[model samples]
Target: MMRTLFDAELNKLNVDLTKMGHLVEVSIENMIDAFKHQDKTLAKEIMDNDRLINDMERAIESRSFNLILRQQPIASDLRNVTSALKIVTDLERIGDQAADIAEIILNFEGEHAYRTVEHIPTMAKKAKMMVHEAIDAFIKKDLSTAQMVIKMDDEIDSLFQEVKQEVTEILKENSERIDYCIDFLMIAKYLERVGDHAVNICEWLEFNQTGTMNDHRLI
Candidate 1:
């Protein structure tokens, strides 16, 4: 009976982690849409939803530590619980990055978007995909998928570089638009950081599977 209960708790841990990941994914999608339309209402909605993600992170952390203390999980079970503790932190930060992007959109208000806006949607999509794949890897305990997530970070980084260069040209051509261009650059930087957080999650997945850390930086 005790073993059965422990197994069920492990299942719940996986479910909770997945729920947290999905919330972050939704935030990314909505933030990008809000930026594209310059919709303050949608941006506010994303910002408001960030609190729920934060709440979920705290709850998962509590549950995971409780499981460790009560069950004293051994071997792979202990790793899963420990990984949950690490993974939730990354998910929480990803949520913050999404909120940060939405806040930037809020600042843009009623202004005309610069040409650099064209690069953002694609960058956000790549970052979101990385997050999705990393979470899937965790759920399935699939090392290859986790490695793939790490590899995809490069494309997002490259896109960020392109955005920075384009923003620089825009700034040089039109000094009056400096504020807007800088905000756009910050948005791109946040998206790049989101990809980094996804990479961090994938590294945790590897640790969960292999009992070792990957000392590599994807960014």
Candidate 2:
């Protein structure tokens, strides 16, 4: 009976994680749309929605802690709960980064600031995919999918470099648009950070599955 209850709670924890992941995925999508259209209203909406993500994080944390205290989970079960705690932290940061990008969009004064860099949207798309896949890997306990998410980080980093080059060229052509270029550069950086958070999530998932991260025992 105790084992059954513990298993049910574990399943509930995963369901909450999936719900939080979906919220983050939608925020990233809305962030991309807001950037493309320079929709201040949508950007503000995304910022407002960040509170929901934060609340989810806190709720997940409490649940994980409750499981640990009540169930005294050991070995793989302990790793599972602990990993959920780490994964939620990364997911919360991803939400914050998305909100940060939205805040940048809200500050844009020119209509074409987003048009100055062509690579940011692609970078955001790839980061979003990584986050989505990482969450899926967690739910399915699929180490291969988690590893693939880690590999995808390289592409996001490469695109970030491309954005920097493109911004530098734009500055060379028109020094007056420095502020716009800088804002776009910051957006690219945030998306790059988002990719990093996704990688963190995957690493924690890997640790959960194999008891090691980067081949070093964590627990």
Candidate 3:
């Protein structure tokens, strides 16, 4: 009877984590759209919805800790609950960074303010893909998918380097648009960070599976 009850509670925890992941994914998508269109209205909406992500994190955290205290989960079960706690922290940060990007979009000026940086959209898409895959890996408990997401971060980093080079050329041609270029650089940096957070989530998934992180055993 106790085992069944614990499994049911664990399943609910997974459900909540999946729900939070979906929310973060949508925020990233909306942020990309807002940036492409310079839609301050949609940007504001993303920012407003960020609070929902924050609340979800808190709720998940509480549930995870409660599971630990009430159930005294052992070995893999303990890792599962603990990893959910860590994963939610990363998810919350991804939500914040997405909101940060939206805030940047809200600050753009002029009627034709949206600059067409060649690599930003591509970088954003890749980063969003990493986040989506990381969440999917968690849902499926697939280590290969998690490892692939980690490998994808290198592409995101390489694209960020290309954006930096492009930005330098833009500045050389016209220093007057320095502010715009700086904002663009920041957006690229945030996307890179998003890739990083996805990698972190994957690493935690690895830890959950292998009983170690970065080859250091915690269990």
lDDT of 2: 0.90
Candidate with top lDDT is 3
lDDT of 1 by residue, 110-174 (tens): 66563346787788888888988988888888889999999998899899998988888888899
State every prediction's TM-score relative to the real structure: 0.93, 0.96, 0.95
Clashing pairs in 2: none
Better model by lDDT: candidate 2 vs candidate 3? 3
Give the alpha-carbon lDDT of every model: 0.87, 0.90, 0.92
lDDT of 3: 0.92
RMSD of each: 2.9, 1.2, 1.3
Candidate 1 Cα deviation (angstroms), residue 86: 0.8
Candidate 3, residues 31-138, lDDT tens digits: the string is 988988889999999999899999999999999888888886779999999899999999999999999999999888874444567899999999999999999998
Per-residue error for 174 in candidate 1, Å, reads: 1.5
Please report the TM-score between candidate 2 and the true structure: 0.96
Candidate 1 residue 204 C-alpha distance from true site, Å: 0.9
Clashes within 3 Å, all models in order: 0, 0, 0
